[model samples]
Each structure stands twice: as structure tokens, then as C-alpha cells.
Target: MERLNGYKHLILGNHDRGHSLAWWLNVGFDEVSEHPIIYKNFFFLSHEPMYMNKHMPYVNVHGHIHGQKYAGVNYFNVCVEHWDYTPLTFEQIRDAVVPSEEQA
Candidate 1:
């Protein structure tokens, strides 16, 4: 909390250990919710991806399925591989999972 000088934060609720820690620590969060977050772009941060049909049009960023599993759906798995967080961007996610115009 002290480390971040000028940045806003948001917290979502789920049955995850890390998220629980973050909710307790971070103080800059503008909003907190038990439901999924929907910003200009959505990042579904969860320990795992369950049945998330409501969060469509917004990509889901989960971290339970080990290794990279790019479902045709807009879901990005950020699970740990050998104790590391594999960072990914929305563009990368769109390119990998979203099909080209011809395919779409």
C-alpha cells in the first residue's frame, strides 16, 4: 500500500487465498465487489475459471489451470508454472484466442 504512490485499485471477491490477502492489504481500491468486475476492459482474476457465462465480451483472466490453455473463448489462464506468474496482455490474449476476421 505504501509502495504505490499514485495508483487506484479495485478488488473482487472469490474463494481464493491470494485475493483474500490482497483485499486485506491494498488500500487504494476505489471499489470492492463480490461480483465480477466490468471496466472498459475486464480482467477476470480468479483462482480458476468456473461457469462464467455472464462475463462475456470481457476476457477472463484466471490462474488455476496449469500450463497455457487457450480456449477459443476469451479466457486467459495465469496459473503458476514452476513458481512464476506468466504475465499476459489483452492484445496477446485477443491474438491467441480470438480468431482472425476470416476465421470469425
Candidate 2:
């Protein structure tokens, strides 16, 4: 929580059980809606990747799964073990998702 001080926080509905406690501690929660966040690029944040497909014009960012996988559509799992946050740029995540041409 100290790390995120001063920065705005938002929570998804599918968040795990302990989120309520965080909310009570004065965190933020914005009901996942069709409207997407368009900073740099359209970005969507959710607990599950499945829900991301329901909307469009946005790149989905999720963190329910411990592992990461990319299908070249629109999904990025930024969940890291032990670390409460992941500091990765979109380009970094894109590189991780897209396979190298040599591999293809």
C-alpha cells in the first residue's frame, strides 16, 4: 500500500476474497464497465481474462492466473509471485507475448 501511495487505485469485481479488506482500508473500486481506459492505448483491467472478450477497442490486462500466456488477441497477465506489483511497459509485455520470428 505504501508503494502505491499518491497513485490512484481501482479494483475489479472479480478480485479475490481479501480485496474487501483493502477496500475498507480506503482503496478504490470501479465496477468493470464497457467503457475502456484510453491512456497511451485502450487498456482494460480485470481479475479474469474471460471477461475481457466481452468488450472491444481495449487491450485487456488481467491477473487471476499465476502463469502467463498470450494468444495474439488481447490479453496480458501481469501477476507476479510475492511481488505486489509488476512494472512492465506495453512493449515489454508485447515482446513476451509475441513469439520470435525464428521460433515461428
Query: Candidate 1: RMSD over Cα atoms?
Result: 5.4
lDDT of candidate model 2 versus the reference: 0.54
lDDT of 2 by residue, 1-104 (tens): 55543444343434445455455346443232333344445566665565445356566776667755544367777776423565666667556545678226
TM-scores for all predictions: 0.48, 0.49
Candidate 1 Cα errors over 4 Å, as ranges:
1-23, 26-35, 41-43, 53-55, 67-72, 82-84, 100-104
Alpha-carbon RMSD of each model: 5.4, 6.4
What is the C-alpha local distance difference test score of candidate 1? 0.55
CA deviation > 4 Å runs, candidate 2 = 5-8, 13-15, 18-24, 27-41, 51-55, 82-85, 89-104
Query: What lDDT does the true structure give each of the candidates?
Result: 0.55, 0.54
